[model samples]
Target: MGLLAFKDAVHLVSRTGLGAEWDMIKQLEGRSQEDAVNWVLHSAASGLRPTPRMTPWLKLEPMRLNDMKTRNSAWSISQREGKLLQAWWVEQMLATHTPFIERMTLFWHNHFTSSIQKTLQPSLLYQQNLLLRRHATGNFAELLRAMARDPAMLVYLDGYQNTKSQPNENFARELLELFTIGRGQYRESDVKAAAKAFTGWGVDNNTGKFIIRPEEHASDSVTFLGKTGRFTGDDIIKILLEHPRTAERLTEKFWLEFVSNRPDPALVSVWAQQLRKSHYDIQRFMRTLLTSEPFWALQNRGTLVKSPVELVIGTLRTLPYPRESTQELLNLCRLLGQELFDPPNVKGWSGGEHWISTQTLLVRNAYLSKLSRGDLNDKSAAGVKLPNASEEQLVEWLLPVKPLQPLPTTPGARRLVRSLLLDPAFQVS
Candidate 1:
C-alpha cells in the first residue's frame, strides 16, 4: 500500500500504456499504487489528428454496381484511402502524449470489431473509430447502445439488410456470442428474437447516418430470454445488460488482456460484480484490475504476449531510436498480423501466444535488432543515445523478466541494452 517499486511501476505502465516509457515509469516509481492507477485513469490524450480524406459512401457504393471498370476503380480507391487511414493512426500513436488513451481506443476497436475491408468505406470506419474513442473509458451500457446504431457496424454485420420480411441474424449472433454473454449462454431463439428486434435499423446513404424505417420493423411479439414483448433494438440491449453473464464475460476478456492468458473464475466473478455495481463503468473496472493482487503478482508478469502494435509502436515510444516511417510501420503491422483498421475477422486478433508465431518472432527480433543498432554503439551520438544507466537498471527497464539468454559477460551498458532488446523476455509484456 506504500509507494510502488520501480519494477511494479514498469509493470503498470507497460501493461496499461503502449510501453514502459521511462519518464512515465519514473513519475510513478515512488507514488502509491492507488495514486499511480488514478493518474493513468485520468490522463488521456486530448484531440485526435485530423482524419485522412476518404471518398464518401454514396460516391463509392454505386460504383460497385455500375460496371467492371468502375468496380475496379472503387477497389483501387479504397485500397489507397485505407492505407492513408492506417498511417493517420500510426502517426497519432507515435506522437501522442497520453499513450494509455490510444491503447484503450485500440482495445475497444477490437471489442466492437469493424473493418475497412468489409465496409469498403474508409470514411465510415473513421467515424466508428471516433465513436469507440469517445466511449473508450465510459460506460459499457452506453457504448453497446450506440454501437447498435453505428453506421459502420450496420454495414459490417449486415444489420442494414435486416427487415421485417427477412431478418438477418449476423449482427445479433455475434453481439451475443462475441460481444456479450459469449457462446453457449444464449439460445438460437434468442438470436432470432434479437435479430427481429434490430430490423429496420439502416444507414442513410445520403448523409451517412443511422435511419429507422418503421415499415420495415417487425411488430410481432417475440419471447427473448423468457421475456415476451415487441422489443426494439435498444430493448434487446437492455435485456442483455440485465443478464448476469454480460459483465462476467467482459471481465474474462479483461483478465486475458491484462492478467494472464488464463483467467481465474473466482476473481473474474468478483471483478464482474464490481463492474456491474459501478454500472459498467470502464475506468472504475480498470482501476480495480490494475490494483488487484493478481495483476501485481510476480508470476503473472510477462505471461501475456505483446501484440504487433505494442511490440512495434511500444518499442519506438520507449526507446531513443528513430521510428520507422508510418507506411513501414503499417507494413510491419500487417506482417505481424495486427493490421490496424482491418482486423482478420469478427473475432479480431487472437492475441497472447498467437502474436509470437515462429515467423512473427523472426520479424520481431529483426525489428528490434535494426532499432537498437542505430546509435546503440555510441553513447555520445547526437541521435538515439542510450540512457546512461547501470547494466542492472537497463535490464530492469527493458524487460519484465530475466533475459532468456545469458547477459553479455563483457561490460558495457549499450551492449547489455542491445542484448536485452532482442531477448525472448522482451517479446512479452
Candidate 2:
C-alpha cells in the first residue's frame, strides 16, 4: 500500500478538490490512501447536484432603431443571468462534500470551452455546465458526443451557422485541435471533412436545445482521418475517439491539471494506455492517479498554480465566512480573469504561470486581507471569535502547503491568517 501520510493526504485533497481544509484533512488523517481516494471519488458521484435553474432573459424581438430600449434591457438581463450562473456554481463548490466533481467539471469546462461572451445566452451556458457536471466523471467519449451537440457550443463555435452549402470550420477545427486531439496530429483536410460532417447541427433559439435540420446536412460522403464515409457529427466523434492520439492528448491534459503542468512522457504513456484500456472511464483513471506513487512524490507538491476559481472557492470554503458573500466572490474571480461561463477565448484560461502576475497577486492578497477583517459584507464572521492560536497553528490551519517565509509575529490571529494566505506557497495548490 502507498503511504497515506498526513502530508500525502494534504497533497491529495489539495490537488483533487480545491485545497485541503483543516477539518477535511482531519477526517482523512488515519485512513488508507485507497480509502481516501475512494471516499473522494464516491462522494463526487453521490453528491452530484443540479445547478440552480437560471432565470431566463427577456425575449425581445429583432432590434431596430425604435427597439433600442428593448435591446438594452435584454442585454442587461443577460449580464445579470450570467452573474447569477457564476455565483450559483461557486456556491455549489463551497457547499459540496465532494469537490472533485466541481474540480473536474472545471477541468472539462476549460477543456471543452464555450463562452457566453460570444454565445450571449446565459441559459444555454447553464445547460452546458449542467451537461458537463453530469458527465464529469463518466465516459469521455459520451461527454465529447454531448458537447458536439450542446447549444452553447453550437453558438460559441458557430456550429449553428454550418450548413450543407456553407460548412463553417470553427467547431470542426477546435474539435480536432483543441478538444480531442492535440495540434500537429491532424491535417487541414481533416478539419474541412469534419466540418462537412457536422453541417446542419444547430440550436433552437426559442427552446435553447440542439436541433438538426436534415435538409441542411451534407449527405455526400466526406473523407476524414484516413476514412471515407457519409459520416454525421456523431460518426466524426466516434472516429476521433478511435484515434490513439486522442487518448494521449486527454491523458496529457489530465496530468497537467491534476498532476503537474510539466509533462513526463513516460508517465503520460502509462496513464494514456490505462485511459484507452478503460475506454476513457474518468473514475477509474482518477482512482489510479490519486493512489499512484508519482502523484505523492515530494517534488510534485505545491507545484500547481491554483486557478482563480480554486483560489477563491477554496479560501471561502476553508475560512469562517458567510454564504451570502458569494456574489462578491464571483466578482472577485472575474477581476482575477476566470469568470465562469465567460472564458477569455476558445482556448480557455491558460493556467499555471499565466494565472499570476504582479497585479493579480496584489489583488489576491488584498482579497485575503478583506476576508480577515470581516469586511466581506456578511454576518457569519461578525460575532464569531477567531481562535487564539499561535503562528504555526494558524499556518497549518489555513494553508496545507508549506510556507515560503516564516509567519510574521502579528498580534491577532486574523492578521496572521491573512499573511499566510498571501504567502508565495499559498499561491500554488
Of the candidates shown, which would achieve the greatest TM-score relative to the real structure?
1
Write down the lDDT of every candidate, Cα atoms only. 0.89, 0.80
Encode model 1's per-residue lDDT on 91-126: one tens digit a residue: 888888888889888988888999988888888889
| Clashes (candidate 2) | 0
Worst 10 residues of 1 by lDDT: 374-383
Best by lDDT: 1
Candidate 1 vs. true structure, TM-score: 0.98
**Clashing residue pairs in candidate 2 (N, C-alpha, C atoms within 3 angstroms):** none
Q: lDDT for model 2, on a 0 to 1 scale? A: 0.80
